[model samples]
Target: MPDPAYRPAAPGDGRRCPRCGHRVSRYNDARHCSPCAQALRREADSCPRVHESTWAEPEVQSAIAARDFGALCRLVRGHAQLRQEDLAELSGLSQAFLSMLEQGNRRLTNIDKIIDLVNGLGVPAQLAARMFGRPG
Candidate 1:
């Protein structure tokens, strides 16, 4: 018996995935099989490190220098290519709170919360020191 998950390709209907030798539905633009695509997504999601160059960007530096937590959070989210949900998961902040903060509807004034955000996002220690007005 054939695999239930496997769909035999009809002409122009599907193609074999290059990565897994499995049928890729025509509707799936990525071309990888579902399992392969899911695995790729998992791998990408597993690493959320912000690139070193992201810290050097003028906007990021400005946000840090200004101590604008909201703007800094937004910049980090963008630079790290993370959704608010992902960032919330990492920072232990609620998604709604992060959205509000990003929109300037809320402020992150509490020192502990600031530390949590900095630590959760893995902001470089030197930069965190600068942000906190401590000599790095």
Candidate 2:
């Protein structure tokens, strides 16, 4: 017999997180529970190491040579297999800003922001130096 005070969570009330099967509130529309989502966000925030061979890629070289941050952002996102939200979190940029930058609606011209982006993406110092025409 079910207790009168016991009420099972209704479908619209909440759902179990797919990752950890933890109860997630309906108010939180994210795919995971708060804890799981936080963990995932933390993981995505870590700097991603770019492979040495990636620097040799024609697209990467061209973007770097042209100093097109929009193109570079797209390339890095693809190479790292990261979503805009993840990349934004890693690079200390907003997802909307990254989207605008990638679409050419915005340009990243601030040196400090550029440094944050490059460092967050784990670009090698030598490559970054070459890109910026600065001593490594």
- The top-ranked prediction according to TM-score is 1
Candidate 1 residue-wise lDDT, 90-128, digit = tens? 788899999999999999988988888888887788787
Worst lDDT window (10 residues) for model 2? 1-10
TM-scores of the candidates are: 0.62, 0.59
Q: How close is candidate 2 to the true structure, as a TM-score?
A: 0.59
> What TM-score does model 1 achieve against the real structure?
0.62
Task: State the displacement of the C-alpha of residue 91, model 1, in Å, after optimal TM-score superposition.
Answer: 1.0
Q: Write the per-residue lDDT of candidate 2 for residues 24-125, one digit (tens) a residue.
A: 775665667789978897887674555666766779777876778899889977886778887887789899999999999999999999999888777777
Candidate 1: list runs displaced more than 4 Å. Answer: 1-47, 134-136
> Ten-residue segment with the worst summed lDDT in candidate 1?
1-10
Clashing pairs in 1: none
